[model samples]
Every structure is written in structure tokens, then in C-alpha cells.
Target: MNPISIVLVRPRDPNNIGACARAMGNFGLSDLRVVDPYEPVWRESVSAVGVNDIMQQAKRCATLDEALQDTAFSMASTAIKNREIKQEIVPLPSLNERLQVAPEGRVALVFGNEKSGLSGEDIERCDVVLNIPTASKQPSINLAQAVILTCYELSRRPGFKAIRHPGQAPEAPTDAQKEIFISSADVLFEKSGFKTDFSSDQRKALLRHMLSRQGLSREQLFFLKKWADKLSSKLP
Candidate 1:
């Protein structure tokens, strides 16, 4: 099974998406998820060249959550260092080590559109954030180039292996499960009249970060959802 998944969010250029697929194919990686692409003609992109099979098999998703529904661990690719919300930033060179500690499941490397890297809200949805170090002369790398470099790193990394803990640890919750737990918590928050200065979006972002950083297991997620339901019932 392919351990890594490539996710492109809101890509504005069809050529870039095609090129990314080509890059993944070069590294023997085929799982591709395009989330809310801006252009609809990506399927016919000429840059895909001989790697049409990867493009043909790409999955189209309406949202990041859908793209990440089955992924247990996700990394948001961003060039921006400073942000409103804080997330653990992992540099490209150190990615192998980071992956070694990640939960045992399919991993996602999420990339935003060419115009903008990942937004604060998007980064919050991921387990961690990663960036390629480049010279100050040109800070932002091309979207396809970034994917190429990332794939190259993973392909060449010596002794790289996905983490496995067998029966000792429960499976990590999928993004879909995380969303369900978050939605239940949001309902409980609303019904309980939980007042805070942060906007609902910001609050959700923070909540997402909290859940991601902990690497909560599926059992923990179900327990939290149950707790939220019970507490919500008592509130109103």
C-alpha cells in the first residue's frame, strides 16, 4: 500500500495539478486527492505528459475534510512562517524523522493553490505544517516544484518506514471521525452558551489544533463524542 497521499487544495492552475501527479508517479506514489480545484480543465492538462494514469485515477473532493477522510496523519505545506494560529512546523529535511513518529496510517501531504500557500484555517486542519527552505531572493517556490522536492525527499530518504504499533495502540482517528467529534463538541458548546471572544471559525481552528496535536486515538474520539452528547443533553 502507498503510505503517502498527495492533496492539492484549491489549485488555480490545471498544469500544476498535472505536474504534481507526474511528480508523484516518478516516486511510485499514486494516491492523489484534489480538493476544490479552481479550474475544471485539470483533467486535460498537457503537463501531465506520459503520466496520465495518475491523473486519471485522481480523486476529486469538495473539501479538505473529504480529501483527508481516510488519512490518519496530515501535513500542511506552507511557505509562510508567521501565522495567527500556531502549529508545529516541520522542515522538509527533517520530514523523515517526523514521519517515523506519526500514527500508523496513510499520510497526507497537503498543498494549497499557486496563488496562496495554506491558510490558517487549512493548516489548523493538519497534524503539522512543513516548508521548504529557500533563499530569501525568492521565498515562494512554484507549486509543482514544491511537490517535486517533497517527493524527491521521501523517495531518497534512507531506511524510511511507516510507523507500526500493532495491537498495542488503537488506530488513529480518521479526519472524518475527528470532524464528527468536533461537530458534537460544537453543538455542546452552542447549547451550553459557551461565550468566548474568539469567532466561531477561530474557535474551531483552535479546537482542531488541540485535537491534531494530541494524536487522539479512535477510542478517545468516540469517548469524547459520547461525552459531548451526554453533556449537551443536560445543558438544554
Candidate 2:
């Protein structure tokens, strides 16, 4: 099973939720999380034929943070826009390769509401924004359709195997640890006069992208965090 979590944010319909559960069953992707769902999922499992077990096992979270706090990486799904994107945007085909490089932890693939989609804060909270290719005439896809498509693609990818050899190195940092590193680095950059070259958001985004791509081991991540913490504390 993939270590990815499918997060539905503020879903307002049980039918759609049931369809999503059914889709996960199709791909053998079982980890499902619903944030602020409209109704209890078990109440609507009638539509999710043969997936009652999955629905019953799904985690119901009260907040996005609560849903993703344990995730090592969060990928936000949204429609593509033509404007300059400050965050890293990965294509669906290349996603498999990206996942291979991502550190070991629960990865969350977050979907927005059926109508409005993810909120601004929800999008920002994610590490990457994933956009599926669609015709400009009909850019928006249904929530269940989106889940099925993404899960289908993910199922096609060669899954990640856990490393057991002691020489394999330490595990990757959790999603929360990465956040701490980013925040501490931001403060250090300002004190070191490094923020002058780029805007704050831009720098933080760049730093996040860079560290993520490096695939830092837990010990290596902590080493950077240690210095960032000390340096930030020394600043006026």
C-alpha cells in the first residue's frame, strides 16, 4: 500500500464521499481522511458498495492541520492557472518519480470542497500544488472524478519499499519538522542579510523546494535546523 493519505476538505455531500471511497478501493489505496465532512461517512456507505470497511476505517479530522500534522509531505490538488506560480507545480505523469524521491512518511494528497475547491490557506499549507491536465473548455472536474484519476495514476507508479538495512540511513524528517526548518531559516536569512536579494515568500518557497528535492535524511535535516535555530536566536 502507498503511504499516501487522501484528504477531502469540507466535503458537503455523502454521495461524493462514497464515490471517493469506492475509487480508493479500486486502486487499493486505503488511507482516507475527511476534514470537516458534511455527515458521518458510515451513514452514507450505501453508495460506496463493497467499501464499508474502508469508510469505517477513514479518519475524520476537525481541521486541516489535524489531518496532516503527521504527514511528511502534503500535495494540494487544484486547477491549473496561467499566472506565474510561486509554489512548485508537478505534472501527474512526473508525480511517480517525485514520490520516489520524497522522504518516508504519510504523504497527504488533499482535495478541496465540491464547489469552491481548496481555500487559500489550505493551498498554502501544502508543500506542492498538483494540477491534472484538462481542456480549457471544461477545466473543473468533479471531486470524485479527481480522486479516481489521481489514485489511478498513483496506483500505476512503482510503490515505495521500506528500507531496512542499518546502512540505509535515518528516516526523513516529518512534515512538521520541515516547517520548523523553514521558519527558522527565514529568520536567519534576514539576520544574515540574505533576504535582500529576494522577497520573503519567494525565498521561503525556494528554500522549501530546494530542501525537499535534496531528500534530506532525518539527521541531516536536524543538522541544518540546529544551525538555523542558533543563528536565528543570535539575531537582534
Candidate 3:
């Protein structure tokens, strides 16, 4: 019953959408947002066994931003391995805890197309990335499968014991702050002559994501700034 919305972006299969709806129903969740869907999500979601009413009430959006306009923050689900990810990877339990006290009133969980998971652009829109562990040989799973796993964890949220994340860690950085931090770091790395053929934005995003997941306190932020300044002095 927490203010969590599941946002599906350009889901290719209507059947998967229906399955996701059913999964949502199982967890007593009804909020659904579909962004740039390839097909009529409501019509396709009619296949949802016991969640027909949810399907009828689902929100369809023309773009991801529109879908998440009311969302306080977003969590992107990624199944690919070893790839550079832009958002911080969080375990299901940690996500559950964070959502319970998330900034703003609501949160959105983003899932990408079945053929391909969320892209860099799609991930950039999210505050964090969640990776569901699976067999190393077969990391990728069906879209519905991923939905069910996440929903299952969500369903058991009330029973989860909350762990007080202490230390001077801040209560997670806002999207804007995260962006600024990463951008600043990128500039410092550039001045340091750190060169990489890899996508620079993605790399910076990953750094931001990691820091955000762990939560950055004022002390940590200041420390990073000092480090950047030190690195800057050594450059040229």
C-alpha cells in the first residue's frame, strides 16, 4: 500500500504486461504506468487473470517523464551483467526500506523492453538501478519474470526488519544533486588527464549511482570535493 508505482517503458509484449498486472495484484499493488508502450497496454492487460480492474485503471503515458511526473524518484531494473550501469544497484530489501521513507510522496520502479533492458537514456531518468541476482550463465530473464520477483519482494516488505543505516550518510541524494556530483567529478577526471574510450557519461553516471546507493552525507560530499581539488592541483 506504499506509494510505489511500477512503470513499464515500451514493453513489447502485451502478455507480459498482463502478467505484470497479475503480479502487482498479488502484492496488493495497483498503480501501473506504461510509457511509450508498443501496443495498447489496457487492452493487452485484459489478459490479467484477477487484475482486470487494475488493468482498466492503469495509466498510459506518451513518454517516460510523463509517466514519472508525480514520482518522487525512480528505480531502474537491469539484468545485464558487467555492463557499465548509470544508476546505483540496490538489493530488493534495501530498496524496500528506502521506498518506505522516500522523498516526495511516491516512487516509481522502471522496467524496460523485453528484447533489451533499459538503455543509458532510460537509466539516466532513474535515481537508482536494482539488479536481481540470477545464475551467472543466464542473467537475463523474461520481463514478467523480473516483475514477479520484484513484486514478491515488495509483498513481503511489511515483514522485513528495518536496519538503521547510520553514520553521517545523507538520506540519499536528489536526482539533481547526483547529476551535479557526477558532472563535477567528470570535469576533475578530465583535468587529471584520465582518458577512456568508454562512454564518459556512463562512467560518471555509474560513479554517481554508486555513491547515491550508499547515500552521501555532507561530510562525504566535502571529502570528495577536497579530493577533486587535490587532483586538480596535480593536473598540468
lDDT of each prediction vs. the true structure? 0.87, 0.84, 0.79
Give me the displacement of residue 148 in model 2, in angstroms.
0.4
Enumerate residue pairs that collide in model 1.
none
> Per-residue lDDT of 131-199 in model 2, one digit per residue for the tens?
888889888789999999998888777653322233756698888888888888888888877636688
lDDT of 1 by residue, 42-123 (tens): 8889999778988988999999999999999999988764566477889999988788889999999999899978878899
TM-score to native of every candidate shown: 0.65, 0.64, 0.63
Model 1: worst 10 consecutive residues (lDDT sum): 158-167
lDDT of 3 by residue, 42-157 (tens): 45555699888878888989999899888787898887586777557787667677677668678788999899888888888888888788889998878888888998888677
TM-score of model number 1: 0.65
TM-score for predicted model 3 compared with the true structure? 0.63
How much is the lDDT of residue 84 in candidate 1?
61
Kindly provide the TM-score of model 2 when superposed on the true structure, using C-alpha atoms.
Answer: 0.64
Which wins on TM-score, candidate 2 or candidate 3?
Answer: 2
Ranking by lDDT: 1, 2, 3
Q: Distance from true position, residue 162, model 2, in Å?
A: 18
Off-target runs (Cα >4 Å) in candidate 1 are 159-236
How well does candidate 2 score on lDDT at residue 80? 67
